[model samples]
Target chain A: MSDGARERILAKVRAALADVPRGEEPEDVVVTRGYVRAHTGGELIGLLVDRLTDYRAVVHRVPAAEVAEAVAQALKRRGVRRIVVPPDLPTRWTAASSVVAVADEALAVAELDGVDGVVTGCALAVAETGTIVLDAGVAQGRRAISLVPDYHLCVVRADQVVGDVPDAVALLDPGRPLTWISGPSATSDIELDRVEGVHGPRTLEVVIAE
Target chain B: MSGTFVGMPAFPEAASAATQNAQLRHNLRKATHTIRGKRAAVVSELDDWAELRAAGKAIKDRTLRHLDVYLEQLEEAVTAAGGHVHWAADAAEANAIVTRLVRATGETEVVKVKSMATQEIELNEALAEAGITAYETDLAELIVQLGEDRPSHILVPAIHRNRAEIREIFNRTMAEWGVPAPANLSDEPRALAEAARVHLRDKFLNAKVAVSGANFAVAETGTLVVLESEGNGRMCLTLPETLISVVGIEKLVPTWQDLEVFMQLLPRSSTGERMNPYTSTWTGSTPGDGPGDFHLVLLDNGRTDVLADEVGRQSLRCIRCSACLNICPVYERAGGHAYGSVYPGPIGAILTPQLRGTSSELDASLPYASSLCGACYEVCPVAIDIPEVLVHLRGKVVEGKGTTVERVAMGAAGWVLGDEKRLGLAQRAAGKARGLVPKRHLPGPGAAWTDTRDIPDIPEESFRDWWAGRGRGQQR
Candidate 1:
């Protein structure tokens, strides 16, 4: 965080690059393309939809004004009675949900696990390849909130969706804790067969609030 | 250097055992496919990924080209930052350095962040052999260690186990290590994670020594970087009194600016995130903050040998993002164990043969593990042409043999095809004998090729005969 520390880190980076042989010059990563037609928030939501679907995740979309209603509806659909909300998530996001709201503050492992779904916002979304990135900050809770729950409902806005990887990288601060999710957690064993929901969320729902 | 898996049969033999294990195959397929899909989606998000990949490859290749210079610079930087740098030419020397360092701390136990270098050197096994216990702090790694299994995936080492299986391993084996698993552990993912957390908490709190592998070592300031998804890496990196890092010499990038490229490339490629959840960086020993004593062991086991070859040297560019492993079709099937090394999948195929040399049967067989599909290349964050290396290594294997049957057969064919008159005679004779040529190949050494493939029958007439009958062979 200090200026001196930043400078020292940069100095080391320059030294590391000194001897790197210059070859075919690298091309700049471009982030703009009009492949999928959606608004910025719509595009972000679409990426979450496509990627989660590819990863076999369930997706939901809601209007910006009715986000709380959507969350409540989603929980009811999944038969979830209690939900974990990060300490910093907007109060309005869960207003419509009659389910018990559990704050993520020093809660015991048993208590956290009792909750069904956790709702949070992502740090960034990349469109070129549909991915949702989370940094352990205010809107996005601690690492465990998204990780521990079996069902995860993440909110993403259109402006947060970047067109490509470079654009997404530019938006991230290296000092923060970041989590990138394309879809729900899944794995492929030796035979190239797929299995979903191993470590992270088994049922991932992205609520793209346009 | 004789680790647990040493004396293991060649890849084909090991693969035969792995391929038949349906459970293992299922687990591997599920893990690799999920990660591969995430990696693909994240990677495609970047239009300049090709450029970034090239840049990553260029940086590593450039670092390896003048490795001696960069290594010296790194040592100087580390020393200036209050850390001691020890160079180890081989695994034995490296292990000795680490063991001595830990022993100096007078600690019998050490907590560890997952590191491939340590695994490659069998450092934990060696330390255990030395009567010092090393606790794996990473969740997946802990599952593997407790279960007494080798890691099957690079990023997620416990990709071979399902949740239920992991719960079983934890419940069955946690007490023997340190803390005991909860009396009633459920297969629920959260409960399983809690069990591991409760089990590992004591190790973190009490550890006197910590061992780590660095993702990037900056030469300018002598800082070491470890990026992880879990907070366990942060705990191990910060809590210990003495910290020891066993890093490959190739892990260095001369400056933090260079690190920016890898930082961008690694997280996106490995976990499909824009950044890792935990990116811990330390410069030497930070007084009153983290580890008081820091020792850096620079390892160069067979890396220089790999660097000697112009084509193979590019392997040093790998960032160990595991993107190649996730996407590799062969890796998805045969799994990591078949590679017979800590590093597995496409990177393992090329790196193992080069590092260990093709002298051993396992090392020799590794180069042929891939189907040369080029998928690994397509997904590589550093753009390693794995197929090219595999083909190149295959050539090396052929050249290594003094007189293989294929060589003998090819030699005889060369003699027959050497002269125009001899070629004409052979073709005429073959034409006369066309009906006798079998539809399928005859049984013998060549049978392996025909067993799974249809052998092409010889043409009814030689092109020369057809040309001669058309009245143009001799005149032309």
Candidate 2:
């Protein structure tokens, strides 16, 4: 019965576009995808670090072998006592971190909020925008874990960093719930003055592993 | 979409008071200038911004041209993803569908993620009529709601309000809504934000159903994407058990790759960020994450009517970035409240008239609101020629009503200009009577035009006559 509304609306849309040549595929519009896809070259990781820090997200560039130590240092610097981690997160990343790693498996929203912060791995990072994409894959737990806590410490491997938005988007799975976080949640609503730490993490510490 | 703006005076009548409000003018100027500066800096960073803009325009045009096919494909994909898709032909139907969905959850309250679609429908008012209370979680929206004020800007709804006003609103109104402001609440932006955070936290954690609007919806994956600064949107999108997204049919793009273009354009154009703090994308219902039961409401209202227009159709390509609003001189002076709609400024000048038609005084007066400066055209991410549409709608308004006086004047001028002899005779006669013409106001309908402007002094000899006589003098 509700299909009547659907049909009526579609019919209106079709009638509205009756003048547009029919049977043309959307591709026939001949869109000029002529924009430069990437703004940086091999320096994308450094660009990403620079951009992230510009938004006040504490960024750590560490050697690949010291990923665990970096995570531990970030957590300790923020004085995070308890941290939430996804069940599928690689053990070595947080192996040296003394903060109690609360597995997000079957944890309620309230319990997740009780933690001081969340430690997660990212799907990819965008250099131009200083964004970290989390698609609830292995290490990036459910959206709530990253959001509920006051602090978020995320790890981004050098290989996972892309030069621009187009590249980062290509790596993401739209089917999975995705969160592209640029910095700690901030608002410029009042007098257009930026005030950080609204609803998301007040602090975002990105540890960039080379 | 709602009748809140009904019975409102026409644009000139409405703007008269706004133009007089010195404080409003100052506030608007400051806020717009700040955002405009930020936007210009970041936009210049991209070397291929022109190409990016063209692609944005082309992509939207393609999607809108074949919108029916995409909508069908979208429905199928969403259904396949374990989500239910509902359709609404207008605001009332959209409101009813959303109300029903919320009622089904048996929840009296629903948290909202600053949706202009919902605002267009006056969904909160409709929900209130259905005995449901909707809480606006965005900081600007919260201020607007608490102050019982209307939104003035698109991206920052309460851009008109400064820190002092926001602090006052929170202090005065927060107690009425579950949470009270701190006794020593200061006017600092951070302090105000913290108060809002504490006030809205309980609502976010406890809400069973969440209602939202999407920035973009991917047809291929049945994904709804929302970009927001505050985690309020994240909470509304993720914490709730039942999630209902009310989106305009025009908000869809064909594929995930299409998102790549907008993801870059929108952030840079709006709020001047490379990316907002959080951008959440979900395809229907996720098994264990985000909202478990999802519903998508595709709203048309008057969009199909807008889509039908060839010249005016570009308005639909607007991503609600408000770059046009920031750069518009008219909007800077007269302010958004003067537009008297959910949408204001350059986009509003064209979009509102088409969506609502010229039936009402406010709607009819909208087309004339712009100065046709073309600044809006320059900064538009989708490159919507807002001036072109404004002129088109003005023609529609003149055609639809009692424009016999204007028509007669135009007809007389056309006749004189049509023949060289007739124009020469008329010009000579005007030259003879040039000394008799008044410098200030003219009589009858011409008075309105001359009231605030000067009547140009007629030349002693007509330019055409001078040109013709010059050739004879040169021959000698």
Docking class of 1: incorrect
lDDT of 1 by residue, A1-210 (tens): 122422333344344345445552222222222222222444445654665566555666667887888878888898888888888899988888888888888565456566888889888776544567776766877655776677888888766767655556556654444456666654332122334544445677877777
List candidate 2 segments past 4 Å from native: A1-3, B1-3, B400-404, B472-476
lDDT of 2 by residue, B346-435 (tens): 999999999988888899899899888899999999999988999999889878565678889989999999999999999999999998
**Highest DockQ against the true fold, candidate:** 2
List per-prediction Cα lDDT, in the order shown. 0.74, 0.91
Indicate the residue-level lDDT of B292 in model 1: 74
B79-179 per-residue lDDT for model 1 (tens digits): 88788888777788888889888888889999999899999999988898899988887777888888889887788777878887988888888888878
Kindly report which residue stretches of model 1 are placed more than 4 angstroms away from their true locations once superposed. A1-210, B1-3, B400-405, B463-476
For residue B269, give model 2's deviation from the true position in Å.
Answer: 0.7
Instruction: Count residue pairs with overlapping backbones in model 2.
Output: 0
Angstrom error of the Cα, residue B144, model 2: value is 0.4
State, as a TM-score between 0 and 1, how close model 2 is to the true structure.
0.98
